[model samples]
Target chain A: MILGRVGRALVVSELVERLRDRWVLIITALFVLLASGISLYGRSAADAQSTVTAPSIVTLSTFLVPLVALVLGHDAIVGERERNTLGLLLSLPVRRGEVLLAKYIGRALALCLAVGVGLGVAAMVLEPGHRAALLALIPPTLLLGAAFLSIGTAISALTRHRATAASLVVVLWFLLVFFYDLGILAALVATDGALSQDTVAWLVTLNPAGLYRTGMLVSLVGTEALSQMGLAVALPSTALKAALWAAWIIGPLLVGAAALHRRQAVTG
Target chain B: MKVQLCDIQVRFGHLLALGGVSLDLRAGAVTVLVGPNGAGKSTLMGVLLGLVRPDSGHVMVDGRPHQGLPRMEREKLGYLPEAVAFADNLSGRQVMRFFTRARGLSRSRADAVLSRVGLAQAAGRAVRGYSRGMRQRLGLGVAILSEPALLVLDEPTGGLDQQGLTLLWEILSEWREAGRTVLLSTHDLALIERRADHICVLHDGLVQAQGSPDQLRRDVGLPVQISVTIDDDAAVGALVAQLQRGGLADVQIATDIDGRHRHLVMETAPDDLLQVLRIVDGAPSSVRDLRVAEPGLDDVYERLLEVTR
Candidate 1:
C-alpha cells in the first residue's frame, strides 16, 4: 500500500509535468480541433448523402490515437535518462517498476483525457441522437491508445536515446497501422486468393491496429458485413479481439518494465 | 548512519571502474571522497545510492545490508547527483513539491526546504530560468527535504559561487552537528580540508589512503616548510651553506630579483620544526621575516596519489 501510494504520487507528479508542457497542450488542442472540425464537416455534408458515425470516428482514431500516444510515450524513459534526471528520480526510495508503471499510467491518463474529452465533445455535436453509438466508441478508442502507449514505452525502455526511440516508434507505427492491412491485401492478390483463411485470420489479429479496426467494425456493423465478403467465418470472434488488445497493452509493458528494472542507472 | 562498503568491484565494458574497494563511512561526521576524474568516485556514490549494483560485493547501511533495507528505510538516505537536471517546464516550487510528495512528505515541508535553501523567491520561476548555482541549491533542497540520516552528494559544489559554497558548508556543518552522516565526493581539497572529518583518497579505482586530514599528513611523512627572508643576499648564502653543513637535507637559498633580499627555505619533520626555528634564530644574519607552511590536504592528497601510482 505504501508502494502504491508512492506510485500514485509519481503519477500525480508526472501529470503535473505533462500539464505544464506546451507540447502536450499543443497536441491536445490539435486533436480537439481536428476531431470537432471533422464532425462539423460531416454534419453539413449529410445533404450530399455522406454521413459520419461511431465507426467513422474509430477509423479516424486508428491513425490519430497511435500518433498521439507514440509522441507522448516515446520519450517517457529515455528522455529522463538523456536529461540526467533519471538518476535523481531513482535515487529516491521508489522502485524502478513503480516508476515505469506510474509513467505509463500517467501518460495514458493524459492521452485518455485528451482523446476522450475531444471525441466526446465531437460526438455530442455530431451525433446527439446516437448516444449508444457514441458510448460504444470510447472504450475501443482508449484501448487502441493504450496499445500504442505500451508499445512506445517498450521502445523507450529498449533504447537509450530519444531520437532512436522516436525513429523506432515511427517505423513500428508505419508497419502496424499503415502497412499491415495493405500487406495482407497485397498478399491475397499475389496468391490469387489462394491464401488460407486461417493465415489471414492470424495476420489480422496479430496487428493491434487491425484488431481494433475489425473489432470496432464487427461490433458496430455486426457479422453480416463480414459474411457478405465471405470472411465472417474466417475472422476472430469479438472475445478474441478483446483478448488481443489486452495482450497488446500488457505484453510490451511487462517486457519493458523488466528491462528497465534490470538496467543500471547511468552515472557520471 | 554508518555505511560500510565491502570489497566492491564494478566494471564497465572493458574498463574496471572499481576493484576491491572498501570504506567505512562513520556516523555523525563528514566523509569526503577525493580523487581524480574517473577514479570511480561517482560510481561508488552510485553504489551507495542503490543506483549502481556492484559486480561482486555488498553495501551495508547502519549495519543492515543494502538489499535488506526496505524502501521506507532507504527513504532516510538522500542523494544529490552531479549536474542533476530537473524538468525545465516545472517551477522550482513545483519540482520540490514533486520530490517531496514522491518521498511522501507534505507540501509544507517542500516550502520549508525551499526557504531553507534560499529558493523561496525563485520558487515561482521555472527551472529553465535558474542559473547553475540556483539549480544546485535547489538540488540541495531536494536532498535535505527528508532530513535524511545519510546524505550523499557528488560534486555538490561544482557550480556554486563563494556565497553558495559558504551556504553549503554551513548546511553540511549543521547536518554533521545534528548527528547525521554526510558523505560527499569532491575535488576541492581546500574545501575538504576545512570540513572533512575523514578523507578517502582514491586513484586508479582503489583507495589510496583514508584518514583525517591531520592523520593523512602525519602518515605520509610530509614536512612543514619554513622560509626565512634575510636582509642581504650574502647572509642568505651564508645561512644556506651553514644549514647544508648542519645536515639539513632539504634546504634552498634564493635571492630576490633585486639581489638584496634572499630567502632560505627548509623542510623539516613536524617534531624538528622547533629545532629548525632555533637554528634560524641563531643564524649569522638576523631573520627579517619568517613563515611556516604546514603540509595541507592538498599536499597529502598529491603525495598519496603519487605513492599509490
Candidate 2:
C-alpha cells in the first residue's frame, strides 16, 4: 500500500522536507566531520595486522549512526501534530502506515547518504587496499541506521508530545547504544551462571546496537573478546545477523503502524 | 452528495464530545455548524470526514452507510483544516503540486488552482514567507483542487484578513451556485449569519437547533421590532391608538427634547409582523418614516444559548 500513488506523493514530500530541513543539514554535517576525523585517526596506528583499521571505523559508526538516525526521525508523527498539519495529512487519502513508511524511507535515505558521503570522503585518505574496508562500513551502517529510524518512528507514533518523543528516543539511544552490552555483562555476572551463554547472546541480539557490534567485530575476524565469553561460537553467519537486523526494522515499523492505528483524532 | 449522520456520539475519556448527535447535509447547500469553543464543531466535521470514529453511529453518503467513507467516496471528499499548515520549505506551487498528486488529480490542475486562489504571483515563495491569509488561500486551493462533491472546512476564516475572507466567500458562493455541497464550522456569527443557507447551532455536543436562517430566527420567536417617526406630536397618539386598535400592544412613545416631533417604538411577536406593518402603513399620513427590524441569526443563536444555559 505504501508503494501506491499516494504513498509516492508522501514519500517525495517527506524527502524534500528532510533535505531542506536545517536540523537534518546540521546533523549530516556533524556526521561528515566525525567520520572523516575518525577514519584519519584510525589510519594513524594501523600500519600492521590486517593493516586497515576497519574496527575503529565500525565502532564509530555503531555508536554515531544510530544516534543520528534517532535524532533525525524521532519526531516523525508528533512534529506534524505540533505543526497542526497532522489532521490535514490524516484527512488525505493516505493511511497512517503510509505516512510512517514515508517518513522511514525519507529519513533512512538521509541517514544513509550521510553515512556514505562521510565514509566515502574519509576513504579518500586511506590506502587503496584499506578503502574497501571503509566502503564496507557503509552497508551495515545503513542497515543499522534503517533499524534505528524504524524505532525512532515508532517512538514518534507512541507519544503525543514532541518533547516527550524527543526525550524518549534519546533515553532509548543511550540504553541501546551505550549501556546495552554493559548491562548484559552485568546480568551474566549477577546471575552467577544462571543465564546461559546462548541466553546472554540472545539478549545481545535483541539490542540492535549490540548485534551490530558483534557482527562487525566477528566479520573483521576480531574475536578476542567473544572467544572468551563463548559468544564467538554462539554467534553464527553475517546472514543471520542481517536477518535479525531486518527483524529490528520490521518489528518497530509494525509497532509504529499499530500505535498510529490507536491514535486518537485531535481537537482544535 | 446528501449525507446523514445517525446519532453520532464521541467521548474523550469521560467527557462526551458528541452526545448522540444526528445531522443531515442536503446536496447543493451550504450547511454550517456554528458553536462556541469545545462545542464539538470540529469533532462533528471529523466524523463526517471519517477521521474520527464515533462511539456508536453510522455515517451515510448518498444513502450508503459507511464506517468511514470508502476510498471511492473519499476521492470525492475534500477538507480544509482549521489553522491550516504545510511543509514550510516548499514553495506554494510545490505544495499545491504535492496535493495534486495526493488527490490523484492531473498535474496541470495544480498550477490552475494556484492561480485560481490568486497565489500565482507568490507561488514560487516558500510557505514560511506567506502570510496567514496566503497560507489559508493555499489551503483553500488544495481543498478545491479535486473539485470535490463534498467539501468540508473547519474554522476556515479564523485568521484571515478582509481580502482573504472576501476570496473565501466568493468561492463558497460560487460553489453554492454550482450545486456543490459544502460543510463548514465557525464562531464568527456576524460574518457567517448571512452567508450560510442552512445553519446548525451546536452546543455542549447537542444539536440545540437547526434550520434556515429565517426559520431559526422565527423558531427562537424573538421580538420583531418596529420604529416610527411622527410628523406631528398630535399624530403620535392617533398612530399609537391605531396600532393598539389593530391588536398590537407594547407601543412605547417618546417625544423629542423640543417636545415637537414624536417617535414610536413597538416590539411584537413573530405572528404579528404583518399586522404591525399594515397598521404602520395605514397611518402613513401621520407616520413620516417607518422601519422594521427582523431578528438576525445572531440574535436567534444568542437566544438559544440563553435558553440552553
Candidate 3:
C-alpha cells in the first residue's frame, strides 16, 4: 500500500536519527551487553554442579530480557510528542493507524536487532551447550519486549508529558521487577510457610516477569523438579506461558493502537 | 473546480475552530485566506489537507469527498505546512528524496523539484542548518513537486525576504497560469490583494467577506473624504457657506482655525464635487487640493471585521 511508504520512511528516518545520536545508542547497546553479561554469569553460578545446556540459556533470557524491553519501550510515544515531531509525521498522507503500526513494528524490529546482539554476547560468555537454549528464547524475548513497549506507548498516548509517562513506566518496572518479589516475601512471612492455597496461587503468577521465570525454570528443570520447588502447581505450564506472552504483547498493542487513533482524532 | 468546502464546521472542545466555513478553489486560480491569529485560517487549511476532519459538511477535491480522496488523487495535491520540520540528520536533498519517493516520483523528479525551489545550491546541506526562510522555500518546493494540480500553502511568505517574496509570488503565479489551483492562507493582506484572484477574509471562526479586492471594497461601501484648506476668516466663512449651499450628502465642517483660518473636509463623491467647487470660488481659487479619497481594502477589512463582531 502507498500508506506503507510513509511507515517505511518513518522507520528508516527514526533509525537513522537514533543511529546518529551516538551517546544514546552506545548507552543502550552497553545496557544490553551488561544485562546479557549478568545473566550469563548468574546462570553459570547457579548451575555449578551441572553442565550448562540450551534450557539454562533460556533461563537467563527469561530473567534478564524484561529489563531491556522495559527501557526501550517506555520512551516510544512520549519521546516523539516531546520532540514535536508527531504532528509533522501525522501531516503526511499516512493514516494514524499506519503511524502507530509503523512505530510498533519498527521499534520491535530495532529491539530484535539489539536483542540479537545481546544474545550473541550471552552465547559468547556462556557454555557451548547453552547456545540452543539462548536461541530458543529469542521469540518470547521479542514478544515480552513488544509487550512492554506497547504498554509504554499506551502510557505515552494517554498523556502529553513525556516525563509523566516515563515516571509511570519506572513505577511499573519497580512493581514488576522488585515489588512483586517483596510482596511475595511478605505473604510468605505472614503465612508462616502455610499460606492459603488461593493466596499462594495468585502471588506466584501475578507478574509477567514471574511468569517468564517459572515457565523458563519449569522448562529447564522438568516437571518433577518444578514440583519440588513448590511452583509447578501454582505456576502455569509452558503452553499457558506462551498464551500469556501472546496476550500480554497483542492486547497492549491493540490497546495502544486504538488509543493512538482516538487521540489523533481529537487532536488532528 | 478543484477543491471546495461546503459549510464546514469543526469544534475543538469549547472552541469552534471553524464555524460554518465554506470556500471554493478553482483550477488555475489562487485564493488567499487572510485573517489574524485564531481566526480559523489554519483549520481550513488542515481540512483541505485531510489531517483534521470537520464536525459537519464535506471537503471535495475535484468532485470527490476527502474521505474518498484516493492517494493517487492526493498525489496531485501539494501542501506546504506553516512550518515544516524535517529530519535534522538528513540533508535537504535527502528530505526531498524521501517525500518524492513517498509521492511515487522518481529520484530525478525529486532533483528537478529541488532545483525549482532554489534549493539545488544547498542540496547537500543538512536541513538543520537551513534558515527559516530557506526551510519555507524547501517546503514550497515539496508542495510543487509532482506538478500537483492543487497547491495548498499555509503562510508561504512567512519569514521570507523581499526578494524571496517576489520569487515565491512569481512561482505561485506560474502555477496559477498552468491551471493548478493554489489555496494560500496568510496574514499578508497586501500580498493577497496583489496576487490572489479571489480573497476570503476569515474572522471569529467565520468568513467575514469573500470577493475580488475591488468588489470587497465596494461592498464595504466606505466613505470618500473631501479635504480643503482656506486662507483666513474671509475665506473660511465663504468655504463653509459654499459647502452648505453645495447640498452635498453627509456634509459637515471638520475644523475651524482659531476663528479665522480653517480646514474643512467633507464626505462626498469626486464627480459630485464640481458644484461645491464652483460655489467655493468663481472657478477653483481659495480652495486648495480638493481631493476625493475613497476607501482601500484595509478600510474595508477593518469595517467588515468590526461590524461582524
Q: Could you tell me how far off, in angstroms, the CA of residue A170 lies in candidate 2 after the best superposition?
A: 1.4
User: Native contacts retained per candidate?
Assistant: 0.61, 0.52, 0.16
| Candidate 3 clash pair list | A54-A133
Instruction: Give DockQ for candidates 1 onward, in order.
Output: 0.64, 0.57, 0.24
lDDT of 1 by residue, B1-309 (tens): 677988888888778888888888887899999999998999888777777878878888667776323466678977787887788888999989888878889999999999989899999999999999999999999889899998888899988888788888988899889999999999878766889999988887888989888888889988899988888655666667766776763887787898777777889888787877887888765678999999888888888888876
Q: Write the per-residue lDDT of candidate 3 for residues B236-288, one digit (tens) a residue.
A: 66666666675664555545546544566776654565666555556236665
Off by over 4 Å in 3: A1-3, A32-93, A125-137, A161-164, A183-206, A219-229, A264-268, B64-72, B88-90, B120-129, B222-299
lDDT of 1 at B219: 93
- Give the per-residue lDDT digits (tens) of candidate 3, residues A1-268: 6347877876665555545545446755774666566556556555541235445455445545565565556556656566444644565677776777666666666677777777666655665555566666666667666777677666666667767877887888778777887888787898797876445655666567776666666666676876776666666655776787777777776776777666633242
Which tens-of-lDDT digit does each residue in A196-218 have in candidate 1?
87788678878888777877778
Docking class of 3: acceptable
Pairs of residues clashing in candidate 2: none
Residue B28 CA displacement from its true place in model 2, Å:
1.2
lDDT of each: 0.82, 0.82, 0.70
lDDT of 2 by residue, B1-309 (tens): 788988999998888999988888877788999999999998888887767878898899889888656666777887898888787888998888888888888878998999888899999999999888888999988889889888899888877888888888988888888888899998877788778989999999999999999888878999888889886766777778877786675899887898767888899898988887877777748677788888877788888999999
